[model samples]
Target: MSAKTATARPDTSKPPKKGSLHHVVQVHYLFTLPILIMYLVFFIVPMFMGIFYSFTDWSGLSSQFNFVGFDNYGKIFQDDDFINALLFNLKYTVALVIGTLVVSLILALLMNQKIPFRTGFRSIFFFPAVLSGITVGLIWNELFLKVVPVFGQTLGIDILSKSMLGNATTAFWAVLIVNLWQGCATPTVLLIAGLQSVPKDLYEAATIDGANAWQRFKAITVPFLLPIINIVIITTTKAGLTIFDYIKALTDGGPNKATRAVGLLIYNDAMQGGKFSYAVAESMILFILVAIVSFFTIKGTSNKEAGDA
Candidate 1:
């Protein structure tokens, strides 16, 4: 009877081997497959292709080209259009980073207070950020071309009489202003988030210690806000460096190309002028410039914060 009761049981001993395709398909692959596929098809492939093409004189159309190494890079230094665009980009970046930070920080501080209709005000301020870059550019284009001219005619003001985009001297400023208006909204929101995340106990403690408002801000607020500030600066700088959509939509690198940014220059070179290889090379240079600027900015701000602490 005891022998007859003994029975075989099913084995539940081990897991599937990770190296098996079946295991991969059944476990982690589904979750990460889409992102990995997209990354490979879009970013990784394009980057390598761009780098390879940069050394060649390949037209955007055909594969036939000479691989003249370093020639494109050397020629860039002598290219006046590229050089001017680079310089203009630098100036635009500086103005954007400084102006956005100043305006956004102020707005963020003001918005942080327990004021009436603060939520409504935030919506109003952030409204522009949701608009299409091209659409915003077109709207501002009308303001500059039509509305401003009408005001100028009524007031007998000379500078506002013409389309600001048509004037080389003022075109750069007009583009910068439009970008500043659109750009500041995002940074303000980010700074508002940063301000909200700050612990209130530190402020309370400082207040109890006879700290004035300015002193408390200087001592506690700035230190805490430094990380967000640096993040804003980096992102803003990158935007300025790679500025394209607004400039393209608004100016199209016109008014004698005075408002031509590096982005426009590259786009014109690749798409418009059919100098794809040269454009790729120029893009590489811009990449280096962006990296250097970001590194220095982050290093400087972080060091300053550490010293203050």
Candidate 2:
């Protein structure tokens, strides 16, 4: 019986080989090779080339040019036009971020509740998000410049008698309104996701404990939604700061350059103004500002979250 049992028992003496872990790591690296190659070819190469050409006076059409070093950067700082554009972009981005956040939050809250035609409403809200910025800008431009004027004349509303795009002050707000209408959909979707992720049991418990709606939202909902809110803030802030297409299509950086964003300025410098190298330098500065702002904003928010946790 003992001999039969010994024969039936499996051997347990073998151990894993020393190189097994190394082999596993090598296989994982092989799996990532394609993405690594793509990043190198598309991202790294372009970024290096951009930085290199920024130092030289390389117009878009010319291959040969002398190195201008910091000359372009110096010019950018001294130019009143660049300063005005930068200031304008700062204000525009701030307003856009605030407007988008408020509008998206309100829509998200409304859509999250038990309501009629919820799915249909969500689809309607999200439909605008799939359209291109340039298309939305152009469509709104026509409405503001032509359709509104006609309707205004018919209705006898003198304030809308002319296109807002023709006025420098109102032109910025017009572009902003169009941008918010198109942009808020993404953040609204995100906020809805955040709202849905909140545990119903927690709300029920809060209700049983005599907590009001506002108190429940403050204590239960906000804490759970922090991560998504962080994502929304970072992404929306970045998008707001780099807005270009809408401005280009709507007013073409007019009237009197009041609505010219930094991105449009860069494009004009490279494509229209024929100062490619200078544009490249301006682009580098913009890149740095974005990087710095994104990094700090994300880090600061993350730290606050960690503390709250």
The lDDT values for all models are: 0.86, 0.86
Query: How would you encode candidate 2's per-residue C-alpha lDDT over 150-203 as one tens digit per residue?
Result: 887999987567898998988988898899989989889988988998879999
lDDT by residue for model 1 (116-230), tens: 9999989989988988888888889889987988887889988777877899877887888888788889889988987887789989998999999999889888877887788
TM-score (C-alpha) between model 2 and the true structure:
0.83
Could you tally the backbone clashes for each prediction?
0, 0
Estimate TM-scores for all models: 0.83, 0.83
Model 1: lDDT to the true structure? 0.86
CA lDDT of 1 in candidate 2?
84
Off by over 4 Å in 1: 1-26, 150-162, 295-309
